[model samples]
Target: MAAIRLLSFLDAGPLAYFTPLGAMALFGAAHFSGYVKPYAFPLLALFISDLVLSFTVFAEFRTGLLYSGWYWTYLAFALMTVAGKLMLKEVTISRLIAATITATLIHWLVSDIGACAVENKLTFAFYLNRLVTAIPYELNFLGGTAFFSAIMFGIFELAQRKYASLKPAR
Candidate 1:
């Protein structure tokens, strides 16, 4: 979990000298532009991680090269990003908190629904069972998203403060 948090921070931060520009290029601009691009990076990361694990690391647990559940999961991710972009114009603390919670909830519900669908024709009790099973995973997602959102918003605000001239005047 610590490693995942670290990777998310490194992946989300926009430091000029320390961070990779490619990742920033993908997620950072959306912070200012209200663009729906940050969704791509997380989705890409999730897909690639799953793909690699399925092929190499966790081959036994892996179901296939592309899990059918991934489509819904990615769609949820995209919607979460779009929610962040449309709902958050600036990186305020409240907005970040709300966005993180929203993202976590969206991922939880959508992914679990996908899980139920994949399993096929589950009853209400089964869906309730799936919802209960998702608690830990949702908590982890909420925690990770909050951690990373804080890092990203903090760094962006720091940069905006330090290099005020670079920011657009409004």
Candidate 2:
């Protein structure tokens, strides 16, 4: 009991520190609340973070302060979120691995398409370069999501064991 409590506390940090991880907690919470909308939390998190990130980190990449390209990029996020919600259903190693791949691929394709559209040029080389450059970052994002998702899911499972009422029905 004491060990589970300690792990739960530790899980809180990872659960909140990153946007994706935080949404995983909300996903679990929503499951506890009742019907799992699945994509709700992840979609919300991705949309908000993409908006903020485009305006801040990659703001200079485009002309305007807020890149209109973000909307397209977010479409991919929504795709992956829906995939995660619908296909995964339960948090497991296999599902997390699959989600990581799906998220990376979706982001790559959408972002590259946005790149071509925004530049007003449809070029294969441009998309190829974008895909190559995006690989490292996408890998990192996937790794982080898997790591934190596992932590959050584990912690939640532990909590449910102790407090049965908190468990989301199968």
Candidate 3:
């Protein structure tokens, strides 16, 4: 979790709008079998990172830890967990790729609602422009999720190979 949280902050900037947030949620949800705590892992990591950035890197834009977009954005984060567990239930490479794309698109759509609401009046054209402008950031975000998803699953598989105890019995 610390590693995930730190990795998120390492690339903080405009380009970082597409951090490993989706991958973190997806990996946690797919790896853990639980109802409550698994969901909290990514959500909490997001909130903590938001808090840290609010005070440090992004302090210029935000006044405090929690912001207006938090509600919508966190909702999207939680949805990624559900999407992860459902789509990546089998944990295959194909499913990971699919989930990464699905989660990223859903995230882009849902999260933009907050950005549009806060920055512009709700309108079709405004939303359309927001989506168009968001393409580059989404690409960075997509790349980050793919890279980290590979790392997360790869490391887990490697660890299981080294220690039989780490592998869950079939």
Candidate 4:
């Protein structure tokens, strides 16, 4: 838990999206292979990290981490879990990339919508403005999603091969 929190803190730092948010959402969906696990687990991660980040690092910026747009982003992440439930199996690199890309795009779009609505600019110009403004964040999320997805799936694949307990029943 501490390791995940540290990683999430690093990820939330201004410079890097090196967090495992997207990856774990996908992983929870794929590994747990159930509805509740997919949403509850990764969302729990977000909850804990957001709480800690709120009181610690991000406190100056905002009193609480649960900002107005947070729900949209959380929903988007939950959708990524659903995408994992539907899209990932056999745990190949290609599948990981595809799923990561799809999920990241979804997260970007949905969360941006919330931002747009909050800013009262759901128009084309607003969308374009955010396109420019949020490009960096989108890129960071994409890289983070892909990087962690690779690690999570790679580790699981290795474990499954080496340990009978990890392998799916035949």
Evaluated with lDDT, which candidate comes out highest?
3
Tens-digit lDDT track of model 2 for 51-131? 555555556664564566666765665566666556457766676667666666676688778877877777889878877
**lDDT (tens digit, per residue) of candidate 3 on 1-170:** 43455555566555455466778888888888879876887787788877776666666677455655678888888888899989987888999999999888878898888788877678888988888988877887788788888988899989989999988769
Candidate 1's TM-score? 0.75
Global lDDT of each model? 0.60, 0.57, 0.79, 0.77
What total of clashing residue pairs does each candidate reach? 0, 0, 1, 0
| Candidates sorted by lDDT, best first | 3, 4, 1, 2
Query: Could you tell me the lDDT of residue 156 within candidate 2?
Result: 72
**Model 1, 121: alpha-carbon shift in Å?**
3.3
The candidate with the higher TM-score, 1 or 3, is 3
Q: Which residue window of length 10 is worst by lDDT in model 1?
A: 15-24
The top-ranked prediction according to TM-score is 3
Error (Å) of candidate 2 at residue 163 is: 1.7
For candidate 1, lDDT tens digit of each residue in 89-160? 665677667767776777778878888888895678888899898786566666656656666667777887
CA lDDT for candidate 2: 0.57
Which pairs of residues collide in model 2?
none
TM-scores of all candidate predictions against the true structure: 0.75, 0.68, 0.86, 0.85
Which is the better candidate, 3 or 4, if ranked by lDDT?
A: 3
Clashes of 3: 1
Model 3: how far residue 59 lies from native, Å: 2.8
